[model samples]
Target chain A: MTIREIGDLLDARVLCGKDLDVDVKSACGSDMMSDVLAFVKHRAALLTGLVNPQVIRTAEMMDMLCVVFVRDKTPTIDMIELAEESGIAVLATSKRMYEACGILYANGLKGNGELHG
Target chain B: MGESLAFHYEVDGGDFTSAGQASVKIKKNLRQLGVDAETIRRVSIAMYEGEINMVIHANGGNADVIVDDTGVTIILADKGPGIADTEKAMEEGYSTAPDNVRSLGFGAGMGLPNMKRYTDDMKIESVLGEGTTITMKVNF
Candidate 1:
């Protein structure tokens, strides 16, 4: 699905890189960047509640197309700027973590396949 | 691009927020060099994990990236409390990082393992109370 669809499905607000709405696909939700990195598949978007700059760095390193912040958590200017620089889209949603993940999952975005080794 | 390109960075352990800057730059540089996306991702992820380890474990360190027609090589050297057991440290779930580091979403004992996972080849050398150096390669 496109990032735009993800936003509509999760009730997410686009924070940056709105131009990239068409390129992203799949989605992974996790606060742990390491876990996200551990399970690298074809997923192109990361949905996370974590707000640190490392989140952007992690997305950049993983070649993810975007990041979605759950529970209406706002990203700092630094985070938005980093996402802009890295060419990764950013979105924030008011839905709680579980519900947001559930909505996306129900809409055909798998966790890029199972969670562990 | 027949000639090898080398980039060096000094990892500042003083700031956690700045830990992955080197890897970010390297990723950008690799992209500019027209490297494939998969190779670039592998090289950056491995190097970023090593850079984070240097900041969290050793105070700070030095990283060097050498790119050529053959492969990309990342050399990370740090002068901090060295690993006591290289074998155990290589394990997927073993970590020496403090609790605070965990809050930052790392130190889950996956750093070294992830490094190994992303790189085509890796080697670790350490001296207790002295320092450690890791060499990893990702072929293009």
Candidate 2:
């Protein structure tokens, strides 16, 4: 699904890169940034409750399409600026991490099972 | 690339907000230099993990990136409390980060393992009380 479709599925608000359209097929939900970094999938977006700038950096490293901040956790201005600079979309939703991930997964996003190098 | 280029950054251990700044900048630099996307991503992720480790464990540190057409080299040096066991630290599920770091979504014990996984070569050198330095290389 595209980011727009994922947003609609989760009732998420685009915090930045509103018009940025990227096809996202795989999704991972984790508050652990290290674990997120462990799995780098193309055309992927992160579903996370963590709000720090590293979340954005982790996405950037994985060449991820966007970061969905669950539970309505807002990132700081610096993080927003960095996301804008990195050309990564940002979204926020009131749903918890589990619910947000479940909605997207139910809507056709998948979990990339390739964990080993 | 005409010649090998090096970029240096100071990691501020006290500032979690700025922890990954160097890796981000290096990613941008490598992109500008026309490094392959996969290679750039590998370099960025490895260095980013090292940068985060510097903040979470050591009280910040210095990062140096040397880039050329064939590969990128990362040297992370820190003057914080050194690792007591490099072997244990390299384990995939072993993390010594404090609870505070865990709240920020780290301390999964994957930092060192991920750094090694993403890079072509990685070396960790340390003195228990003085410091630790990690050297990683990612080939293009």
Candidate 3:
């Protein structure tokens, strides 16, 4: 699905990268950047409640297309600028982490695969 | 790239937030060189993890990245307390980092494992109370 569809499905607010929202696909939800790094496949969007520059850096390193902050956790200006520079979109959703992930999952977004044992 | 280009970076151990700067540069450089997306991702992730470890445990270090027609090789060297148990250190969820470091979202004990996961070959050379050096290679 496109990032616009993801935003509509999750009730998310786009915080940055307004121009490229429609170009993204795939999504993964997690607060742990390491876990996200370990498991993210070609997933384009990350659903995270964590707010740190590392979150943006993690998305950049993983080649993710965007990040969604759950529960209305706002990203700092530095984070937004970093996302902008890295070319990853940032969004915020009012839904809690679990519900946001559920909505995306129900709409065909998936985790990279089964978690590593 | 031709002639096996090499890039070197000095990781500042004093600052945690600055840890992944080298990895970011390497990722950018790789992209400019037209390295495949998969290879770039692998190199960046592994180097980022290693860079984090250096800041948290060793204080800081130096990273050297060599890119060639075959693959990419990364060397991280630090003058920090060496790894005591290589086997235990490699275990997932096993960490020697302090609690404060965990608050920063690291110290998850995933660094070493993630490093190994992303690289085709990894070697750890460490001496207690002295320093440590890690060499990892990712083939295209």
Candidate 4:
């Protein structure tokens, strides 16, 4: 799914990279940055509730395209600036992590399983 | 690149907000050097983990990324409380970071393991009361 589609589906506010039209192959919902680093091998979108600069850094390390802040969580100005500098699109949604993941998954954005085949 | 290039940075442990600065800069450097995306990602992830570890456990450290003909090598050294058991420390889900770090989205004990998983080679050396130095390599 494209970043715009993700924002539309989740009713999220595009925090940064408003003009970005990138396509994300997968999505991972986790507050644990290590799991995202250790497991996710594809270019995916991270849906996390944890609000910190490291979230942006983790996504930057993984070369992720977008970060969807779940549970109505808002990142600090530092994080927004970091995301802008990294060219990563940021989104904030009121949906909880589970529901956010479920909505994205059901809409054809699968997980790492796509990499196997 | 025929000549080896090295980038060094001092990780400021005083501020948790600035932990991964080195990694981010390294990522940009690698990109400018025309390193492949996957290799850059791996190198960035490993270095980021090491940087975070230094800040959370070592109270800050120095990070060096050396890119040469063979590949990239990252060395992180810090003068802080050293790990008593390297074996246990390598295990996933084992962390000594304080609870406050956990609230910041890390300290779940996945740092070292993630570094090892992403890098092509990894080595850890430390003294009980002295400090720890981690060296990791990623090949092209």
TM-score winner: 4
**lDDT of predicted model 3:** 0.87
Cα distance off (Å), candidate 3, residue B50: 0.6
lDDT of 2 by residue, A9-116 (tens): 888988898555678878899989888888868788899888888898888888888899999899888888888988889988899988888888887788873563
lDDT winner between candidates 2 and 3: 2
Question: What are the clash counts of all predictions, listed in order?
Answer: 0, 0, 1, 0
lDDT of each: 0.88, 0.88, 0.87, 0.89
Error of 3 at B39 (Å): 0.6
What does candidate 4's lDDT look like per residue over B62-112, in tens digits? 998999999999999999899999999989798899999888888999888
- Interface C-alpha root-mean-square deviation, candidates in order: 2.4, 1.1, 2.4, 3.2
What TM-score, computed on C-alpha atoms, does each candidate reach?
0.95, 0.94, 0.94, 0.96
**Model 4 segments more than 4 A misplaced:** A113-117
Q: lDDT tens string, model 4, A1-117?
A: 899999999999999985657788887888888878876547689999999999999998888899999999999998999999988999999999999999999999999723210
TM-score of 2: 0.94
Model 1, B1-140: lDDT tens per residue? 88999999999999998889999999889999999988998898899999999999999999999999899999999999999999999998898899988888898999999888888899999999999999999987
How good is model 1 by TM-score?
0.95
Note the residue pairs that clash in candidate 3: B13-B59
lDDT, candidate 2, residue B74? 96
Which candidate has the highest lDDT of all? 4
Q: Which residue runs does candidate 1 get wrong by more than 4 Å?
A: A113-117
Residues B1-140, model 3: lDDT tens digits: 56899999999999886679999999999999999888999999999999989999999999999998889999999999999999999998999999887767788888999999889999999999999999999998
Highest DockQ, which number? 2
The residue pairs that clash in candidate 4, if any, are none
lDDT of 1 by residue, A1-117 (tens): 888888888877888985744755567788878888876767478888888999999998987888999988899999999999988899999998899888888877877534322
Please give fnat for model 2: 0.80
